[model samples]
Target chain A: MRYVTPRKAAVGLGASHTGTEHHWWMTVSSAALALLTPSFLMVMGTALQLPERADILLYFTRPYPAIVVAIFMTLGMMHFIKGSRIMIDDYLEHTARKVAIIGFSIFGWAVIAFTLFALARIQLAFAQAI
Target chain B: MADVNRGNRPLSPHLQVYQLPLAAITSIVNRAAGQAMVAGLLLLAFWLLGAAAGGGLWDWADWLTRSWFGFLVLLGSCWALWYHFLAGIRHFFYDAGEGLEIETARMTSIAIIAGSVILTLLSLIIYWI
Candidate 1:
């Protein structure tokens, strides 16, 4: 069985190598994020504030819901970075302006990377934390 | 215009070359965000699959994600989100008949970029702690 290389299978990135290398990851992330926003907004809007942080965590941790939340956080972070890249390019008119914009973008990626580490830990260690 | 100064400027097929309207720029940004969100979901799927498969498949993913490079890519996505989230809101605003003027639209665009950066940093502080 042969698996396709990135160059071969990234049809979404064809002709021009943009927004295609991470197609599956991006699509799934968007879908999950798309599902999560409304739910989180609802949960945040009505709650009378939990007494303990851990309790709040516990409330969100039950199986399917927890999974959804995790997906939400991950996709939210991912989309932000890719989205920013486009935005930066839009307003940065000068060459230096573009560089500065891109530099800020790199920082965005940095934040996501660190946040993911936290997410991975929280998701995998769900049983032990409680 | 940036092009007014140069005699023969080499144009690199770019989005900036287009006479972009607020609607057009907003659409482009939304698509970028939509695509990236999709990537994030895919990454989550890998994690979920790993969690499901038991064995050590998921653990391997966990390990990679925790690695230096994986962390970097993930962080990039985080930024993508903060920016897109705001940009998405801007679109919603536009949909509601706001930021229609050229100046107002551009200002809103700038605001979206600045606000997203600020928010992304805030999340990192919380996450890092």
Candidate 2:
């Protein structure tokens, strides 16, 4: 269907609310930005800018840089999710859309959770060495 | 859609309020985002490149952090990063069925600005290295 029927729209009270500009912004940003994220990650995977690199693990075992990494990962992961959430909302209109959305939703949460896990468990060897 | 009627007179399409004009707002968002993306990618790519260059170059980066110029640049980046982060949070709240009122929107606008600065300073102080 091109658009929601009036009756369906009435039943979709929260759905209409879900379909907002902010949601669109996040969705559009997520899908569009996803194109950039993987490239950046591949770069990070090879590079050693993380705190624990360069035989300097001892220097970086402090609290400040750890906080920085924690902030960066947490914010980046959350942004990635809301962004992809927007993409799912806008383009997934089929019957399997629910499953797709759920799957992606879990993936996003998993990324955030994993990032948090690393943030808490960061050690010089693993965190810095990549 | 039926045209809005007012006092028995047919009203023209209410081109939504463009306080500064639609083109201007779009231009603002586009330009700000463009500047941010350019700077952000450059920083990310440069850091990766530096890391790939090995220890000597990496040591130099650590030294740069001590310089006035580098510190200023990092400070600016902190602002940008936190600004984007807070804005993303605002967007998240909108997704969660909050922050839709006129008052709340204004609060979020100010809050994002304040939050960015506050978070940046807090992160800096709380940093590991």
Candidate 3:
């Protein structure tokens, strides 16, 4: 019933030298998101209700909403990158898996960057106006 | 030595062989919900980018979101968000060595499904009000 070969057991290597780093990051990010999700939802929900584009822009200028969006988008996308990688690994193989993992990771980061840039632009505009 | 009888060893039934339990369905749905939320994130990005750019881009983005199709997509995203949130909580508890019992797990799965639906409806209702 020995699954490990004698020579292999002697060498004792495991899948990726990283070892639980992915799991650890996922756990930490998910825990943070559990706390952040409600506030993030509230911020987004409020922003959506604003009547005009200017009002929506002004809404994000507030400290609370801006901060919530910043943290949530950053951490949420990082969590997504990890989660999607696991999903891609499970269902995809070879070139498809590698391409998907790379593509999704890049996409996740691009979203985070653009969203944060937008938030920053809004805040800066508000600052210059007042 | 283990290899001697490997071919004769009975393996567990594959995924399609048996009816999936509530917990399994919940688990897979959680993954699906996570995937679905990506759409929501992209929409959010679009809105933010438009807001930053202003003018036509902003108006177009605004119109798109307010459209019926956009509303439907958002509604699904809202449900997915809540579902995935609850599922994350369930997994947290599981990691803490709680709620692993069959009946408890099943009850929690049902709760996750029902709770997400209620939360989504409540959010929408509040939004419309």
Candidate 4:
């Protein structure tokens, strides 16, 4: 009753060689993002409305807002990395596709790193001042 | 057993020849919106980094984001976010084996498009108020 052929079973993954991992992760991240998007939007909306630089910084200094942003940015970028790779795979081929995937993966990670670093700095500065 | 005629064979109707259905259009737009959100995220990262760095960097980023050009970009980003978000929900329903009927799918596709616009406008109005 096994649907898979002997070769497919031996190879484990399907023709693409990626199996279902990409789709699985994309589903998980998309579900998490479904919740995170609204909360993050509210946080960003409130932060942007503040007129003063210090006030904006102070707003993110609070643990709740900071945590929301940190999680959102990290998860969102990870989702983007996976999602964009699929899009690139569909439209590009060979060398160009390889380069685009690598470029986007690096960009996504850098954004995550920069976002966490900024959030940390905001928290540290607020701590030192008070 | 190479019988030839591979290159000469007529192919199925492709993107150019076929008019895509509503569901197909919505699905493709969802992908496009996801990419747009990436650009929006980069703008957000710049804003955050500038705030953390402070001084001239913050001033420059703040001014840039507050400018008319930036406003347009943010507005588009807002719409993209809503469109993608609603499309994600539709996808979830599809995954769960719901709303897969042709009529239902078309209705939901239209709802996504209209709902996203309404939500985007509502968010902006709330922000302005």
Interface RMSD of 1: 10.4
**Chain A only: TM-score per candidate:** 0.53, 0.50, 0.87, 0.89
Q: Which pairs clash in the backbone of model 3?
A: A1-B2
True contacts kept of each: 0.00, 0.00, 0.65, 0.70
Against the correct fold, how does model 4 do in TM-score?
Answer: 0.89
Q: How many residue pairs clash (N, CA or C atoms closer than 3 angstroms) in each of the candidate models, in the order given?
A: 35, 11, 1, 0
- For each candidate in the order shown, give its overall lDDT on alpha carbons: 0.57, 0.51, 0.89, 0.90
DockQ score of the complex predicted as candidate 1: 0.04
- Scored against the true structure, residue A107 in model 4 reaches a CA lDDT of 96
lDDT of 1 by residue, A1-130 (tens): 6699866767666654664554445555555664576564334222213433345345544655555555555556456565555565566767866786667566555545544554455455676854
- On DockQ, who's better, 2 or 4? 4
Candidate number of the best TM-score = 4
Q: Number of the top candidate by DockQ?
A: 4
Q: Candidate 1: list runs displaced more than 4 Å.
A: A1-67, A70-130, B1-27
Write the residue-wise lDDT of candidate 4 on B1-129 in tens digits. 778667867778887999888999999999999999777778888889999999999999888877887778888998999999999999888988999999999999999999999999998997888
DockQ of each: 0.04, 0.03, 0.61, 0.67
Clashes of 3: 1
